[model samples]
Target: MSIINQMLKDIDKRDKPQFGANRPKSVYLGRPLRTRRLRLILWGGVFALLAFLALSWLHERLSAPASDARPSAEQLQIQRVPVLISEPTQDAASQRADAETADASTRAEGEPEETRPRTTRGEQATVVVTDLEPTQTRAEQPVEPVEVAVSEQVQVPAQTSMPVVTPADTTVTASDDPGEMSIQRSGNGVGSADRLFQRGMDALSAGHNRNAVQRFREALLVNPDHIGSIEQLAAIQFSRGFAGEALQLLRDALERNPGASDLLLLKARIYERIDEPRAALDLLRGRQFRLPQDADLLILQGAAATELEEYTLAIASYRQLVSWRSDQGNWWLALGFSLERSGDPLNMQEAAEAYRRALQDRSLSESARNFALDRREALGY
Candidate 1:
C-alpha cells in the first residue's frame, strides 16, 4: 500500500509540472483568483451605490420649485413696508453745521453768551399706578350729535421755536377704538386750531412728547373747546402714564360739553384704566343714556357687561354689534363667549350655534377660526 501511494504522488507531480520548488500552490494561485473575484464584486457594489445616490439627488432637485421665483410688487409691499426718514437739504445741513460749530467755539472760549433757560417748576410728584381696573367700556351715550364748534379765526401763536410747518402729504386716520376720536386737517391753509394741532401731532410723531404737550396746550388756549386739542392732549397724558390726569381733563371737557359722546367714551376708557369697570358701566346706565343704536356704545357696553359677569346684557350688546356688522367674526365670537359664560343650560346650544356661525365666516383669521372650531367641537356641535 505504501509503494502504491508513493507511485500515485510521483505521477501527480509529473502531470502538474510545478513552476517553483518549495512554493505552496494554494498561496500563489488560489489566493490571487479569490482576490480578483472579491475586487470585481466590491467595485460593482460601489458603482451601484453611486448610481442610486445620484438618482435620489436628481429626484429631489426635480421635485422642488425653481429657486428664482419672486413675489409680486404688491406682495412685496405688504410683506416689507418701507420706513421713511426725514432728509435735510444741503442748505439746512450747512446751517445746522454752522450753528453747531458756533456753539462749540462759544463753549471752548468759556465766554458767557447767555444762560440756558431753566424751568422754575420743581419736580412733579410721580403718581403710582394702582392695580385697580376701570369698569367702563367706550359707551358714550350722547343726547345728540355734538357738532364741531367753529370760531371766527383764532390767532396762531407766534413762537419762533415752533417746528416749521412742512408740507406732509401724509394723512393719519385716528384709531377707531370706541373711546377714541379722529382728527383730520389739511397740511396747507388749515385753521389756526388745526395748524397748532398738526404741529402738536408732528411733535408727537417725532417722539418729542414734551414739545407735543406744549403745542397741544397752546392750541387749547387759542381755541379752548377744540376737540382735537382735548383728545390729543388727553391721549398724550394717558400714554405718558398719567391716566388720572387724562381722566380729569376728559371730565372737565365733559362738563363743558355734557352731551359729547367722545368725552364720555374717553372718560370710560380712563375708568377702565383704573380697574373700575363698574364705574365705566355706570357712566352708560339709565334709559336716557341707553345708546342701543350707537355701535361704539354697544361695543363698550358689551365689554363692561362681560367684565361684570352680566352675561345677558353682554349677549344683548354683542348681538346688536353683530347685527350692525354681520361680517365681523370677532363680534360673533364675543357673543358666543358671552353665551358660554352665562351658565344657563339653554345658552350651551346657543353658544355652539354661535361658534359654528363664526367658523363659517371665511373672513375670520386662522387663529380665530380655529378657536371657534375648537369651541364648537367641545360643545358637541
Candidate 2:
C-alpha cells in the first residue's frame, strides 16, 4: 500500500509542472488612485462658471440706458399757498422784495406810507395778509359759559376771561347735569370780575374759604351783576356759619336777577342748611321763584318735606324725582321712606314695592340695602 502511494505521488508531481517558479500577476491597480488630475478638473469647472458670470454682468451693464437728470421746477416752489399781489408778477419773491425796499425808503423819508393800495392798470385789488394784520380766524367769538353745580357739595362755577357785553336778554340754560346751571354771558367790566371770580374759585378749591370770600366780593364790586361771584361768595358765607349774610346776598341777587334757578337753588339749600324747611318750601313754591322741574330742587323738597312730616308732599316730590332718574338708589330709598310714613293704608303696598325696588338697586348703600330688606320682610311683601 505504501509503494502504491509513493508511485501515485510521483505521477501527480510529473503530470503537473514543477511549482517552484512564479509568474508576476498581470499588473493590477489596488484601490482607484486619488490623482491631482481630478482636483484640476474641479478647479477648471469653477473657473469656467465664474468667467461666464462675469461676462454676463459686463454685457448687462453696457447694454443698460443712461438716466439723464433734469432740474425740477418744484425746487423753485415756496409753499402750497402763495401770497398774491394786486397785480401778480411772474417772480413773486422779487416783487415782495421790491415792495419791502419801497416801504423802507418811505419810512426813511418820514412820509406817511400810502394807506391806500396802489392800483394796477386792469387788475382788481387783492386783500393780502400783512405782518400788521391779525391772523385769520372766525369773526364771531363765542363766550365761555359759566357752569354752576350744587348737588352733593358746593362746586365753584366755571368763569371766563373774555369781556362780553351783557345782552338785554341773556339766555340761561341747564348744563349737562341736572345739578348744573349754565348762564349765557353778555357782560361789561368782564375782565376784572372774571379774573377775580376765577381766583376765588381757585382759592375755594384749595380750601381757602376766607380768601375766596374776599376775592368773590372784589369780583362783585367790579361788576355787581357777576352771578358766579355772588353765588360763590354766598356759599362761602353760609358754609362759614354766616347764614344771614348768605341769605341776604342771595336776596339781593334775586332782586336783580329774578327767577334765576341757580340763585334759587343756592338760596333754598342755605335755608335747608339752617333747618328752615318751611322757609325753603315757601321759597321753592313762590310764584316768582317757580322753576322747571329740577332734580336737585325736587330732592331738596322731598327731604325738607319729609323732615316737616309732610309725607304727602315728600311722596309727590320723591315720585317725580324717581320718575326723572330712577337709577338713583337714594331717590328710590327716599321714595320708600316717605311712602312708609304716608297715613293712607293703600300706600303700604306701594311703599313695599318701593322698598323692593330700592333693594334691587345695586348702587344702594349697604346700610340702605339692609334697611330695605328688613322693611320689606316686615311688610310681608
Best by TM-score: 2
TM-score to native of every candidate shown: 0.46, 0.49
Kindly report which residue stretches of model 1 are placed more than 4 angstroms away from their true locations once superposed: 1-190, 286-294, 363-367
lDDT of 2 at 227: 88
lDDT of each: 0.67, 0.67
Candidate 2, position 188, lDDT = 63
For every candidate, C-alpha RMSD to the true structure in Å: 30.1, 23.5
For candidate 2, lDDT tens digit of each residue in 63-127? 66443233233222111112222211113444344455445544644533354232222322223
Off by over 4 Å in 2: 1-187, 206-211, 286-293
Ten-residue region with minimum lDDT total, candidate 1:
77-86
Q: Per-residue alpha-carbon lDDT of model 1 for 273-320, expressed as tens digits?
A: 789999998887652334443567678878999999998888988887
| Clashes, model 1 | 13
